[model samples]
Target: MLLATLAGCSLWNSGSSKPLPADLGANVAVLGVRQAWTARIGNVGTLPLDVHVAGNVVTLASADGVVAAVDARTGGDLWRATLAEPLSAGVGSDGKSAAVVLRSNALVLLESGKERWRQPLAAQVFTPPLVAGGRVFVLSADRSVAAYDGATGRKLWNQQRPGEALVLRQAGVLLAVGDTLVVGFSGRMVGLNPDNGSVRWEAPLGSSRGTNDVERLVELVGRTSRVADSICARAFQAAVGCVNVARGSTTWTQPASGAEGVHGDGDAIFGSESNGAVVAWRRSDGSRLWTTDRLKHRKLTAPLLLGRSVVVGDDTGLVHLLSRADGSPLNRVTTDGSGIAAAPVVAADTLVVVTRNGGIYGFRPD
Candidate 1:
């Protein structure tokens, strides 16, 4: 899908992008080789904290206050929008539309390149607005979740309440399960009504104590032949669970090493445990079928499952391809030596991810 934005050149500035250079000996992402196209974007003195890609359009925001829409295939420039206020992470669509956090304490929509609408925020608007049902759903830093009319940008209904004790700086996804709007925060989960900002439910997530266990697990697993080849040594043996969005009930809980990346498709809920444990549970009973212990990085960028494998990026800049069936190794690739900050997205069967180094890579298994 081709997206057209405001074509004026006055509203944007360009910045330089630090090059990945090249790593000749790396098994993957051999620097300097197989370069599709590289372009330098300048305008903000800060890095874009958020990235999103869909159909032929990929959108992201920079701290320097510029929003960029680039061609997914060729890295061609599509449109750019610079707001006076600081920008937030890219969210709202499955990757089609983008939303930013504004300095005025509001969340605004940036589509193609046009200003869709600007809605008032209660306190610090942190979570990326959820764009669906002709409205945008945003969870403010203060705990109130509001939904605004998508087309006319009118306030529908907002319910206010105290927010969590703290919101995690690490990024998490939002879900609109029926009328329950859920935001996964650090150590807790809050659910709000999408049409009206009312508390539907809240679930408490546990605290992660040790951050260095990842390296230890990797070393321990490496010493054990079967465990080393199957599970990364830095395996997480922490609590992992999901809460209900309607009544704030702690529906089910299990020990996980890290926050599992969660996905709620209509029929099933999908995500991975901190130690690379993958499970697909029936939405009705949360029962599981097959499992795998292949993912090893400690970061929380959720896994994106494709055909026979689940694709994940880690803190070491290595992209591991593990089989989705029982969690066996398929292949791994390296596009950059820098670690990945965001989760990988599925473009058909091809996987795409933007690294912390400010470069985007699209890959397919041979």
Candidate 2:
């Protein structure tokens, strides 16, 4: 399906008989946008490299294996590092430390522009390395989860599960909630002890219904953003549900058809559907509030809550702003022709986004 291809494998180049749709031009404008600065990371081809914001620094990585940290306010380069091999997934960080998964199935940890340690991984990683609790957690393409010592890069514990042959290549999320590390893997949300990788609780968020393997594949989409007391997540065409972080019980379940995942703004849950539709639901009861089809057929990234609007990028380097209250189109903007591949990050007063063509842009909404 189209959702499977949105997992960063260039849906535009898919061998399918259907052709990709073109992005719509700027139409309605309500909110004003002021671009602060634009920077280049590297050429965007296939590998997953994202922009991560921690405190005042935004870290970015490129396919050619160049990593840099830029000042969120002025887009000034704070530090830069180059890897020997191409990067697969994006970068992850705890503000103080950062991690990246290499094309050689290796994990590299960086801090203060220096390589702290490097460790070989058994399987190829499609998800970003998570740094938390003095450990680095990684979810590999083989459906394996491993934790390593943050300083020494020593393998501490690992867990593996059966994976489908054709799995979604999009990066799933690893969240740290209290003492447990919540991991989104193959249609399931798992809570594991950060110290030992033991399963404390698990919730089935997706089900296999397709006769073919690709249709049957169910994986988490974007990073799990916290909404009130619950943690909400979306599965690739499987389901989107929220669970209490403390009890690990489902709060609600809805059919998930998005490749880019979901976002929440304290009051409402927003998601970009596979059909290019944007929908908002009540965070309290998962009640549908509004849906907009203006961006239909456009490959949209995950929704980003900015001010009172929901911002999302499309396949043609277009950024859309929708009302968080009713999902109405408020404004739209275009990037440097390279479509945005990663979710927009909020850093203080500006919004940051990265395009597949290696363009990073900062916009200040006015």
Number of the top-ranking candidate, with TM-score as the measure: 2
| Local distance difference test values of all predictions, in order | 0.52, 0.80
Can you tell me which runs of candidate 1 are displaced by over 4 Å? 1-56, 71-74, 94-97, 119-122, 152-154, 178-180, 184-191, 199-238, 242-251, 263-300
Candidate 2, which segments miss by more than 4 Å at Cα?
A: 1-26
Candidate 2 local lDDT, 10-71, one digit each (tens): 44336656444545555767888888898888876666655688888998888888888888
* Cα-based lDDT at residue 366, candidate 1: 49
Candidate 2 yields a Cα-based lDDT of 0.80
For candidate 2, what is the TM-score? 0.93
Error of 1 at 308 (Å): 1.3
Model 1 lDDT per residue over 1-366, tens place: 111111111112123643232232324322112334443333222232435556776666555456777776766778878775665444456455567777567777767778888776656644456777667776555445567777777888876654224343323445556655665443456666676666655565454455542222210000000111110111123344445443466555544444434443434444655444566554444466556544532333456656656566765677666655555566667656666656676543446666665566766544
